[model samples]
Target: MFFRQHRYSNLIIPISYFLDLLIINAFASLLPIQFQTPVLFHAYISFGWIVISLKNEFYKIYRYTKVAYILRLIFTQFVFFFLILYAFIGFFKQPMISRLALAQYFVFVFIAVFTIKFLNYISLMRYREKIKGNIRNVVVIGENKKTNQLISVFKDRTDFGFNFMKQFSAKSLDFQKEECFKYIIENKIDEIYCSISELQNDELTQFINFADNNLKTLKFIPDNKKIFSKKLKFEYYDYIPVLSLRDIPLHNPINAFLKRAFDIIFSLIIILGLLTWLTPIIAILIALESKGPVFFRQNRNGIDNREFYCYKFRSMAPNNDADQAQATKNDMRVTRLGKVLRRTSIDELPQFYNVFFGTMSVVGPRPHMVKHTNEYSDKVDKYMVRHFVKPGITGLAQVRGYRGEIESDTDILNRIKFDIFYIENWSMFLDVKIIFQTILNAFKGEAKAY
Candidate 1:
């Protein structure tokens, strides 16, 4: 569900940064440390502090982040910052910079920073809990055990700042989408939550699209299947897991920028370091064995359901079904070399170009053939949700053994589940893990690789 904007919330990080530097410099001045140029030392410390904080995500605190996590971040940031401080002293050869004074300065800075940070955190919590500031008005669209638990949370946790407005049953004959929209508009609801089990795919899509169009937050109460994945953000209301539909980490601008930067650097490394030499060899082999072009390009559905020409090293003889059919185990269409390339996953390497060009990501939901996208959009519930992020050359599903031929309904379903998980829970760490797993799978061999 949507969060109401706190006027000062946006300023919290910048203000914290400012106060932290202020404390560092102020403590330095008070401590008995001789400096050649006080202004230059201040500048060095300030720049070093900013760099360390950015690297460590020191101020990336969230409402749901625990006090322990915040404390851990503070500890980590200071340890690195402490090193930076000493490096400056050592580099400048400031013999007059007293070691005892530096230690004293650190203790003072730590206490001051710690006190101010917690003071702000505790103050905000108290304000939200006691005064009900920064409140968000939310409504539930279906009745179920999870929804009831969530309603209880809204009622019990005043500090969360959720104002429970009303609950409407999706199963009731009186229920209408238009009526719910009208109520939301009249009541000025900030968030809408639906019970995924109660609503049809069409109804779910309608609510999702409506939320996007109206600029309201939409969340879901997952059914009692215990389908919680590591990637999806589950905000625990007491014991109930409430799933956020659009709370993807990559949706954050800073996160998006970081992922994009990583994609570029990684793709460049692969393209320049490996593909420059490997491509010609593969291309010659494919040409010698096949009548068609060395590279295969087929239309695939990507982010936002847009079609793009996905590239692959041709592993099969030229065929009309290239765009429509998936390669199956021991398929006659596959050339002898194709089997090795497919099994090794070398055939998929060319999509690094797609990652570099921005049509795809290094780790995301694998794009399906355009025809399959249309067929599955109608057959599979929440299938289109995977298109919310760019398609990937290798993905969680691939590493989890759900790649290649969609032999059964369960196959596609499981793949989409993992894909959704990747989209929801994406981190640089997760991406790297998936890539490593992909590499291991390639070397170890996969049953469905063909």
Candidate 2:
């Protein structure tokens, strides 16, 4: 329900933002500059600023997020806008881009969009608190230290919204069914949160049956399971509790949505806008060098143990899946055109489609073959934990020199360590920095690129 409402809320700002951009562009065109260039540039600039705002998490509807937090985010958005504008203008040395107009547009957009978003967030929080609507009522089913801690945290934080109608002790089987029924009847509970270890299969199944009959939500709070230790950070949703088993890096919902939104829009621009103009040319070269399929699709594990077929331009002689080998330096399978593609990282362009499909991120731990996953899971400790988040086109490990074939166990271990570090310390600034470093590294040709 929250997700649906959030989606509906998103529609309002974007619509208002589009009108604001149109006005900004209209204002930009009035100035003395190239008519089309400045107009389009301002439009692009507005779009970029909006994306940065969303990426920086100005859109997350926090129930009790301090007013100071909201202002800090707004200030960060202004900083990003000016920084990006100046950097791009300086890098391109384009004097025609109207600085004053762009600055005005930034101010205009920030005021209009920021006000709408803030109002939406404040209004939603008020609605949830005022009408007592959309706040999930949750019951914790456990009698252990973990449950005690959970209760203590919720009791101290009223903004969490769980109301904490009652916590049922899971110590014994006697009076379990009757007490559970009584709690349901008296409290009018809407959900159940349980510690994973506290309940056996039979008890869990019984509770699940009751929950199903009662039409309540059942989410588990996992203890520091080794798998969760990799990236999970549990958080409460109002009074309702949830276990965050995987960290998608963008903690703020709007930031995460923006990162992904940009990935899709950017990937579409690359594939449809750019690749359409480049594919036939590259295909001819590949066909001339090697008579085989022009693309390669391999099954790779993605976030949450899902498998997706990752695509890349064929740079090798289409090896059989039954007898595949990882590419090494000066491999015989690579064609002359393939070498150029591999060196320039053009072969991975097709994966923009993977990003568009929501199976990959523009930056994250790169996905490996299922066979490689199995082989390395045994060799490297906590290797599978990297699969908690969507694999990326480029990652912190790749930037820090842990790409290419894992020749040593230490290499794989260090790579996993870096991947986890990136996951834990994820922020928009970090992602932007990694992307910049990736571009610079590609230009200098790192040793791991092979």
Candidate 3:
């Protein structure tokens, strides 16, 4: 069966890792510095190399990865590795180990590793082009400018190793889904490329299910309209851009774990260090001003559109419209203390608990009230895509002055645009940057903070 085919390609990463490690140790042995414990030295450097490579994604070169990206990885990896080498010598007080010899060792290792990497990359391209090995037989499922561009890539870039078998016009009356399926099965098509703009919702789902069942790779050729946005991940087939709709960085298990860990650790600090005392003080102030619960909880749309009761300091007098209406600037429902709370963004501090409980993140798209979520989702395009990640206490949209009342449709639309950007291009540094900016915004006071 096509699904049962042995994929030796899976072994490439591991094999590459092993070869790099081998090169590192072999060069270490040739160094003039006589290590007191040779095995210890080798193990330390090898472990350091692996850790650094994994952190930098040094070996994540793909067929579509640009040569410039590979060079950047190599530069980043070697710079860090050089620091690791010097740190080892300094920490161990290796007086006998000559710095000059170590530098030479570093140069030799870089030369050897660089030569091997490029050689392998070029060899694979040559092998695919000349021998037609490691080829994927693919079919295009639409006829359009974008699809034609992609088809041209498959035909021209033999080094990419895609064999274009046929083109099926999804819009054509003569095009039958069953016939396409039969052809795919009989010809052992390895991948299916569909024009997302050309297919109906049902047609897209059917192809997705068919590809999933057959273990065939599925990709989309998106319309050029959304290509300018960073919301979707784009890869170049030669010069043609092909997008993956759901390929956000946080979708990776490692990245998701890292973001979640940051959320938990950061929330713990706030909840224990600040909120423990601040919550009671705020509660007393709210009680003094109005009659209501210290913590206001309302159901909000969370990750995957799941409903969760989001927590915030009680910033309004008990009212019927708390869940249905957003707080407007100079609104009467806001208590005297609520005005102060909202202005300083202290009302949002209680959401750290939500973060600790894992219902939200420290930095992500902000969750909206259920009423607004339902209303906007119907009216706004790609608004629901923000639900792909956990809601944040303060998001890119909030920091960028899109928070508070939605005065106009453009306000919500701009918020959605920022939210989508955050979801797609998330990183640890980006989260930290947003947190710092949020702090600065609170101190300065935003016009929309009312």
lDDT of 1 by residue, 271-347 (tens): 99999999999989988887889889999988667789999999999998888889887899999999999989999
Identify the candidate with maximal TM-score: 3
Compared with the true structure, what per-residue lDDT tens digits does model 2 show for residues 359-434? 9998888898888876776666557667656789889998898986677788888988998788767776787888
What TM-score would every model get versus the actual structure?
0.58, 0.55, 0.59
The whole-model lDDT of each prediction reads 0.84, 0.70, 0.83
Q: Write the per-residue lDDT of candidate 3 for residues 47-97, one digit (tens) a residue.
A: 999899889988767665678888899999999999999898777777788
Model 1, backbone clash pairs (residues 3+ apart or across chains), number: 1
The whole-model C-alpha lDDT of candidate 3 against the native structure comes to: 0.83
